[model samples]
Target chain A: MYLAKIKVTYKPSVLDPQGEVIKSALHRLDYETVEQVIQGKYFEVRLSADSLAAANGLVESMTEALLINQNTETYNYTVEEVEA
Target chain B: MYLAKIKVTYKPSVLDPQGEVIKSALHRLDYETVEQVIQGKYFEVRLSADSLAAANGLVESMTEALLINQNTETYNYTVEEVEA
Candidate 1:
């Protein structure tokens, strides 16, 4: 089995309202050091694949399909082997 | 200034309770294909530093100090130059 970790984030040009809210909250909570806050989605999948290459192919297809919307967001992933 | 995108996620071995809740929610929403929903924090920092190396240094320090709890969570980052 293999483990795939994916991260999805909005494009830099887009405005992140969720992040803005969190930034304000942090400021209110006295976290003045926090200059900005951007929120993104994280996914960890346990693949049934036999090898790293297979796992990567599965993850890449998933990312390109329903996992992310390429129009407004971008994503990247890393894969590792799982020890049984 | 450089743009630093940092992603923080829980260690794979640890069970993610938040992800469980989201997974259940997705199932209820009829999104059965959604196998898991692990959530993580993302930060988009606009550094005051002049170069990518300096920005990386700042980001590393920030990650080590407060952005990530190394004991339970791990983080990775990518830096890019912002065109003027």
Candidate 2:
């Protein structure tokens, strides 16, 4: 099986309200050491593909079509093979 | 500066509705090869700490106190130095 490690996050230009909230929460907890907290979605996708190349293509398409929003968010991912 | 890569996900025992919805969407997109998807929270935490050990300690406490909910989710993180 292939596991696609997907991460989708807001564009740098976009304001991240959730991140701001978490950052404030951290400060409230007396963690003044925390400088910034940028939050995003993480996904571990398991799929069946013939080869590494095939898995990469599949994951890329999945990421483009459903996992990420093109206008507001950008994403990055890595694919690795694992024993099923 | 330090960059902490944090991931928090639902425990295995919990049902992931968002993941299921995405899986179904993938199937609709003819990605029948997709087996499963586990979704989680990802954070890119930028902070200042004295050293790697200090960064790790700081991130751990932050994760425990603010970033993750102990009862329903589990988390893991990696800390690395980055240019400010």
Candidate 3:
């Protein structure tokens, strides 16, 4: 088995309203030192594959096809082998 | 300056509807090898602090108080120094 840790976030140019809200809330809560906050989605995917290379390929394709909006969002992931 | 990468995830016993939905979608898309999907929130926080320890402390407190529900969710973070 392989466990893929993926993070999907808005592109730098995209506006992230949720992150903006959180930043303002933090500032109001006295965390004035907080300069910026970028909110994103995290996913842990466990799958069975023949090898590390196969696992990576599957994860990348799955993430691209189903997990993110290609225009406004981007993602990166790390895949690690794990015992089933 | 410091950059804190935080991940907030539900406790093992808690239900994750979004994850379940994604898992079903993946299976439908022919990713039958996928065994599980756990969804969570990710945050990139940039802040000004005196030291790495101070940054870590601030991030921990902020995350516990604002970013997660202690009753159902747990969080982990890594703080690293960054160019201002």
Interface RMSD of each: 4.7, 0.8, 0.5
What lDDT score belongs to each candidate, Candidate 1 first? 0.72, 0.92, 0.96
Q: DockQ of all candidates, in order? A: 0.25, 0.89, 0.94
Q: How do the residues B1-84 of candidate 2 rate in per-residue lDDT, one tens digit apiece?
A: 999999899999989999999999999999999999998999989989989999999999889888788888999999999999
Let me know the TM-score candidate 2 reaches against the reference structure.
Answer: 0.97
Clashing pairs in 1: none
Tens digits of lDDT, candidate 1, A1-84? 666788888988988898887667655654454566677787776556657787788778766766678888898889888664
The candidate that achieves the highest DockQ relative to the unseen native structure: 3
Query: Which prediction has more favorable lDDT, 1 or 3?
Result: 3
Off by over 4 Å in 1: B1-84
**lDDT (Cα, tens digit) per residue for candidate 3, span B1-84:** 999999999999999999999999999999999999999999999999999999999999999989999999988889999999
Off by over 4 Å in 2: none
Chain A TM-score of each candidate structure, as shown? 0.92, 0.95, 0.98
DockQ for candidate 3? 0.94
Count clashes in each candidate, considering only residues at least 3 apart in sequence or on different chains: 0, 0, 0
How much is A62 displaced in model 3, in angstroms? 0.5
